[model samples]
Target: MKLIGLVRSIRALGEVAEQGSFSAAAGVLGLTQSAVSQHIAALERETGLRLVDRGTRPMALTEAGHVLVRHGRTINARLEAAEQELAEIAGHRAGRLRFGSFPTALTTFVPAALGRLRTEHPTIVLTVVDDHMQGLVPRLTDGGLDLAVVYDHEALPAATTGPLRRVHLFDDPYRVILPARHRLARRRTALSLADLADEDWVGGHSGSAWFRIVRHACRAAGFDPRIQLSSDDYRAVQAFVAAGLGVALIPGLGLVSPTAGVEVRRLRAGAPVRRISVAHLDDEGQPPGVRAMIAILVDVTSHLRRAEPRRS
Candidate 1:
């Protein structure tokens, strides 16, 4: 008469009959032993059948209980097969790679990575989206993305809870951007954080991840940087540095071309590094396409490391 009652009874009955002990069944199910006993008692009461003989040493199940247990196992197995078959059809043999990434990686890191993947897997489809770490974490959890490339920094705001796994790739170091005429620029070598303590600085918008990285790196070198200008755009930061206004900390990940007159100097001490990682939800069994994309990503990083020396 009661569908919910019957389902619960079947599950409890299957557990108790399989383990041969109410206490063992309850432990496996994370329920109290009394709850398991109560479920069995309720089943017998509702069906007007004696399901278990409690006087037996290892609690013998009656004929009705044995029948229900056998049928219950079959039902559970069929349900599992249905779900797995659906997932395989939906995800398997799909040539698409749904990748999410932040801006810095988008500028260069991902493009270079994709170039390498193309040579080996030319027919594989790739879909890429750019979003902040805070925005991407939710989409990753909700199944909107297959993988995400992100930069981890201590000062950045944390995202809400999500089911995902992070695979660390590498650390991208930050360099100081200065005018071609700055005294440190004439030195023709990387300058230490201590060497720039008294220098004026151009920075990103207040409370931005880059701003925090610059602030912390400076403080770690025993001085607070003087911010003369603030803007979120890297080009804007470059413009400020080019005019001899101030120097700013820039990451090496995307620093390919010069900014007309802007120059870059490596910071010897407290050269802040941002961690790059790939994120994906832990599905029970991953699809082949997902596995291929992961392989491509790892290969890309390996190739870049072996290439010519990059500007710090």
Candidate 2:
């Protein structure tokens, strides 16, 4: 039998053994149930031995099936290790890269990095999962994500650091937004929180990540911001600020487009900066694609940090 076909047949056999039914195995393999049945039938014809006890409720692997499955799993593991070794030498020549990231990054540096990765490794398949950092980390830990773009804040609870390696990328500082015609809009210097003590706040959702950061900073500055409207979308927040609804604090990543009537400025000091990182399984034997993705992330974020964005 051809090595590739033999591997697929063996993989299907093992999946059937673990799942207890051809239908379940088909679901896992993204194939029709009849395809799994055909693979098992072909294996039986090739081996001249019946491998399944189909009369049983969930089906059972026969003695021959069990033995083949045990050996097949070992073979599959070795093949995977060999593939990883070859990938390191060849640099993501063939394999799927499962990656994840938060929404803003998805729209920002992450997409550019993905474009470069596709250019460098055209044959590499990509699976992207876009979500919040809290949702993405667990997926990484549970083997769902091979690589992810995650962020950490010194003021916030640290990222979960077990069994995963985080490659530090860049710091995303929170910047202040003001109405274009507001008094502080003309100031070249970073604004102090006290500079807006009397202004209403157009902030993030009441209890969301950015909201908490803004609230904490305002408290540190000796006044609680009076939130007039809570909006998490940076564009909408900028629009609100432009209309003089209130001043707002937005992360640098979200400032890529500030709309027409809002001015962007830095916090003089004590601004919350989120550190971006590329995370992957640390147990080693990482796929070349994962490492390649990390390098791309670094390159993309570095450009983001250095580019002088045109003010809107």
Candidate 3:
């Protein structure tokens, strides 16, 4: 078989393995089902082995099929990397980047960095996905995103066991949000986590990462927080605090605009900080657009760090 035909057949086999059916793979590859069947059939003829078990429902890849598909995926990834490098070498600014970020970062420095990127690379297309670390990490690993802005709290560290290359962005310190008229709001000294042990806590949904972080911080201070209210929205959590519902711990990025009737205060000790970073696949070299965006993010965060309010 010709090299081009062999590559196409391998790609078709990989897609079939992923999509689980010839028709599905056909749709994904923008080819007719008959054409997809011919490609696989050609591969089977060239390999002298049955690559797929047609007797199974949703299709099943034979042992030979699995081996070829695995190698095919690696080949595809390398080809993609080569294409990106060649584009940069040829001075092609026109490309698309799939970027992901958590909600707070999306609302904070991400937009500024994206705007700067657009100004500098006018021909580059941008697609942004807003998701939590749980969603973003998997996407990065599976090549669903080119880059992501992710964070992990000090109380509960992020998983670091993957093929992810991360660049430290900045630390977003967690602060106590209190009702303006609450007694703790009047304290001249910074309050410890233990000081709010008895207060009703407004927190993230039960069993969520943020909720776990809050529980871990409180337990470290020798108390189990009595979380009476829950919300995933940082703004809503601030609202609950302002209404005197309960005190909550919110990160600095989430407090870009503190709700009215709320007081933001620093922790005297053991403040939980969210360490933000830009992450990408380790095997893929940073394309020009990705590198440019990362640099812009660092610049934007530097200005934010300087302008952050000093709450004590």
Model 1: runs farther than 4 Å from truth?
1-95, 116-125, 160-163, 303-312
**In terms of lDDT, which candidate is stronger, 1 or 2?**
2
lDDT of 3 at 106: 90
Candidates' C-alpha lDDT = 0.76, 0.81, 0.84
- TM-score (C-alpha, index-matched) for candidate 1: 0.64
Between candidates 1 and 3, the one scoring higher on lDDT is 3
- Model 2: how far residue 118 lies from native, Å: 0.9
Q: Which candidate achieves the best lDDT against the true structure? A: 3
Q: Where does model 3 exceed 4 Å of error?
A: 1-25, 34-78, 91-95, 154-163, 283-285, 304-312
lDDT of 2 at 181: 91
TM-score on alpha carbons, each prediction: 0.64, 0.67, 0.76
Candidate 2 matches the true fold with a TM-score of 0.67
TM-score of 3: 0.76
* lDDT at 243, model 3: 94
Between candidates 2 and 3, the TM-score winner: 3
